[model samples]
Target: MSGHTTTFLDGLEALAASPLSPALEETTRLRLLDWLGCTLAGAASERARLGQMLASAGDGPAPVIGTGQTVAPLSAALLNGMASHVVELDDGHRYGITHAGGPLIAALLAMAHDPRMDQARFLKGIVLGYEAALRVAIACQPEAKLNGWHGSGVFGVIGAAMGTAVALGFDRVQLNAALAAACTSASGMVKAFGPGSELKPYNAGHPALNGLAAALAAEAGFPGPEDILDGPHGLIEMLRGSPVPPGALSVAPPYCIETVYLKPYASCRYAHAPVEAALRLKAEHGIAPADITAVQVETYGLAVHKHDHTEIDGPYSARLGIPYCVGAALALGETGMAAFSETALNDPETLRLMRATRVTEDPALSALVPAKRAAHVSLTLRNSSEVATQVDLPLGEPEVPLRAPDLRAKFADLARTAALSEARITALADAVLDPQTDPRTALSDL
Candidate 1:
């Protein structure tokens, strides 16, 4: 399992042969549905304006998720992935910092709609992509995010390329070439979030497009390095600032599917635990919004970086703002897609709550994140009565997983905002759960 020997192609081969659990398959399918719903909602958003422009430029037969128009496969993946994450409501793996479902599902659906790709292979490719992204993210480890890179774009390129290669039935050599090309083309920066730049959504979309381009390039007789991930100028060295460790590319059982955290809240994953803690305290003590005087949240080191919003504004800002998310949860008793809206951000009560909320980094808690994402919140009442709640496992943690019912409910909630019909919602959920039944057929009705 030497790093050089364990190439992306090798990982893809292992994943293709790996046995997928029925439950895992169901999870993957449901995630697809959730991401599709997000994409559909974002199709008309100003955040997705770039995606719309790109979609209009292509005329291939690949279907965009919400829109009826078809574009080139790469173009569709880029647009769909961009739109899916435009609202920041898409699914993300907490540890990986990669929005697994966004790019992966976008590319899978674009390929799935192609008559040449059978449903079974399409589904398998999606699973393979998930595993690949997770592994690459893990191998890159702490440096993946610290080095001013977006894991979804850097590692996601590898995952999307591997997934697309699988769906296209590339031989091992071709798959290796595709991955090499992906490794070379992958690029994203964490700086996009710092300034509330429109580039944030492109972080999700660009990797998908690069990945598809990699696969297409490989198919068109391009040659790539056999050691793209471990070479001196490889992805790990360039993006991660270190060579990938030996045996870093092994594709194990369960993969990252078991470790992936489905987001229950639309905000940053770092903020979820604090919000959960606050919500738990509010629910248990029956604390009203006016009863809170101040709130203090102790979370990982990243919380300080995320919550330090002296100039927060707009939905994107709220989504990345820890104080805003915690305050909204405390004041509204919930934090969902609706809570990140412009109206919600400008709410007087939410601002008051945000002003009262203070966030700090706890080394002890910081050590537990990515795997745990734990947090502790302290609430002080108007009368100085204090209550504290700590959450080690939030709602969507791998251990405290969200059930099918909860996922369906979340889909419906998002659909309500998107104006999707009840029938459309049900059909979308069913088509994802049973992807063999042509999910596009359900989209047609929409």
Candidate 2:
């Protein structure tokens, strides 16, 4: 085997042997549960509507979480993925700068419904999916944030394909074919962030569908190019504007799981630093919205792109708007799904505060892109007592994880919006904690 193949096989072997830690397992389960809840809550969205329409035209017995409709595995993956991410509340990987949870979870759930699959193998598949996705994400990190491609979809398909291949018992050659097919199918643009359109969810869903297609194609003896990543017109050469790094095509040990950052809030991870700083300012010294004279936010280059919203006016706008998030955090002490409601977006007081808040891209901060993601917040209070707080590391990072209580609280808060009963929530949590339990049962309850 070539060095690249050796690297990938080594990573796969390590992943196959790695036992799922209780904390990591629980975190994964919570993320899936949260995704299902959010999907159900946002089932009426345009993305969901489109997914339902597309699913109606497909075949099979895979379950669609919120709608409780049975469709083909590919269709279910697409629909559920779309539903989970339509509202932009799904879990994200800070280091990879992608939402791996949506596509990976969608594919896992679809496989979970398969009678031939076992829970242990299913859980392993999830870990492997995350490992592959994060590895590809980091490998392609250079173009991910800079070139406006949604890494979640671009790298997510590869993860889903790997998981699907494992679930289907594909050998090395078959896995390679599936990987190549996935690389060809991967695509998503960062423009969705700017507009916050239905395309955001589509980006999430497309990867699941693409992965399924790749695996299925590989199963049917479909041939794939051996040098997919290294080809002249391949992923790196065509889309990234740079040559693929030597040996980058191979995967390796430790995976990206070690560097993955879980999220504390449902909002964009890029907006978290400012939100954290605002919350600290409010809790530490009793800084109220009215007491704030002006707020300045300095962030990395990608942060500016992720949160920049000077022309947005709708709910989507508020979600991606750094000024809006910072303003809302300052005024309400938190930024949740409810905080992005139309009424909240149009609130005169909130708008005033948003206008007062200014965000600029600092070269020093921008220089830390894709590595040390950091943010600095400066607030000039009405009393002229200026307070500045800088968050070098946001909460939910691998080093600074949110506690179980924090995760439970966030899950409850989001679930409450969907009107899920306490009993149902507990049952879901139970299912997540027990890897032996069927995850589809937990999703079905949602």
Candidate 3:
């Protein structure tokens, strides 16, 4: 048993020391760009404003993303993580059901603040963090989610620790300790949905802070149970409330980050397929919102279970509601930030459409989950006409990846949405997209 644990830790350490392929490095850069766009766009939110205020009060070496403020490394990680996730547009993995980039990148930036940190090393850390954290998430998901736990708050902490360990050059022992310590603080609840969804960003922030602290503790000679990830009562059993699945911890991969999806809508990932379905119905059938009598949506059980609500209290609530997202997409032909704005949320027509929308679970679709985020949408018209569409996978999934030009356009739009000046947006874009740029300098100037 001890040897198994030792082998696991050694494998992780070796992954950290391994070199990334050119393709993997490119993907890392894109993920960074995506995270930066999300963080910068989210900086305008009240949550990010509060985070910046809290971090600005403290002084340290780490730069808080989307702000000119500097704070302690931990504080920076918390703030950046919060900002990145606040907009609900961060990149996410389908199988793991986790947003790996937000917290992992937050931790990496916090630890890579030193001018001497190599850009290659920082990028490698990003890749490693996603691999490790997402693997844990894959091992615990659906079950953990069904148990009311959020993977970002749980598995994300471990991912952050692994990434930080790589950045800080921690040995296998220290890495193991860091991971073990992270498990102690792994927690977040799915009840944060609906009107309480505004608190969801804390899942990313809390994990980023805790994961960084865990790695730092290990670096400072603190001891922890190395087998906390796989031993008795370890994170797998604790989170899943069952025995660890066989081979769940295996490191074999073409890089799990490659499978992560970049969000095309500013709503929960569960809502994406439905939104796409609705948009297709509107565009192809030329069905106006006024002409639609009612809508029925069938999707995977997890989506229907988590996002079926129509009673939206605010922007955050709107993001979590599949009914609202589908309604907005049908009504406005889009589900970007504008769809959740005060005017849109309060629009009587949109609300009426939302009320008329119904969501249900299709067992076939449910079984397809973690492999395909399929959705079926049908609309009945005032004239008794019917239109239907089914999306096996929404845009931005690995199979339907967003084009580089489109991704860059998204970044530019988000930067402008954050009220960034033209020059700053250009500079930030250049810095993030260029592999030769110093990460510390690229991050600090924002």
Candidate 4:
């Protein structure tokens, strides 16, 4: 391959061979903790229970998250991946627009059952996985999403495969073969987020299943596409249309995980902006739910187009509806798991506000999306008062990240909700944050 054309292969080789820095390792460690909290919390959900049933057949050593039951490695990967994403609380990268930690962490955990994978190898695997997914995402860009393909489902196939390959110690050729296989498996429709969204979490699991299959296929010496990503009519061309960006393949250092966004709220990432705005208004003015007469949220195109639903009957739609999230944030001053609970769903005041709210796709804000993700909110009060606020970067973005204490509290909150004892929660958090702690031991208590 020519130097310019070899970007995909070169990037794959570099990330697979590169060692993560200590700082990045710590970041990875924190995200691991964050991921476990999401998994444990999600395991209690109805969706996660269904995932367990689907993956219940595997009897391998890999443990599905938050349960003592062991399943086959692939099943474990699928269940854990699905659980992590079920709550919409997993880590997300804006550029890639996929929750990277779900598939990456799930694949790595399933692979860790070998008892030979060290903590260092585990961390490196996650970095490489994010690298692969992020590169693919960059190439696809707005074009992929514009066409209704979910990046997590499409980009994550190769990413999860790469992580599995890293964990299994695959060489360049085997990794390429695995990626080729993954390309064949890439799929997911944004339609899953529409009405009757039960298939949404399954979209997250698809990558884990397909990715592991690709890696295992490579290890078994099953020949697959070697140039499936960059060749004519390859994965990129098929998904992104012709004339894809050259920079998409130009892999750089410091990796993609450096800017990963962890969730501070349980709602969709797209809704966080309005949620934050509403929360800020409530906090600053100390307004009760009854004090607000109407709310208007203006945001970017995708958020308005996909997330503008006014009625949220269940947890699934509650997590996806911007109107519900903003109303809940305004009413309760928070949008965590509690806000999506059954009680929260029946909240009369919140329902009233949700019904009264308006969400529109602002032309200016829409123009800035996939870049700024900004949102503007205007609230009208009962006593002839008005308030407005805007947020460019939501709280969990790297620019305005949750502090260490807040991160700890977030995890502690989820751990408690998952019924973990104080001792087990503390030990798990300690192990997850400690650079030297093995991932296997970190998960032992769970």
Clashes of each: 0, 0, 0, 2
Listed in order, each prediction's TM-score against the native is: 0.93, 0.91, 0.96, 0.96
lDDT of 3 by residue, 1-94 (tens): 4533455566677777778876777788888888999988787765446654664547788877666777888888888888889889999988
Q: What would the per-residue lDDT of candidate 4 be over residues 233-273, giving only the tens digit for each residue?
A: 78777777866655667768657777778889998999999
CA lDDT for candidate 4: 0.81
lDDT of each: 0.76, 0.73, 0.83, 0.81
Residue 213 local lDDT, model 1: 85
| Candidates' RMSD to native | 2.2, 2.6, 1.8, 1.8
How many residue pairs clash in model 3? 0
Across 279-340, the per-residue lDDT of candidate 2 in tens digits comes to 88778887778888898889887778657664456766676777888887887665777677
Badly placed stretches (over 4 Å) of model 3 are: 1-7, 47-57
For model 2 the TM-score comes to 0.91
Enumerate residue pairs that collide in model 2: none
Kindly give the stretch of ten consecutive residues in candidate 1 with the minimal lDDT sum.
1-10
Which candidate model has the greater lDDT, 2 or 3? Answer: 3
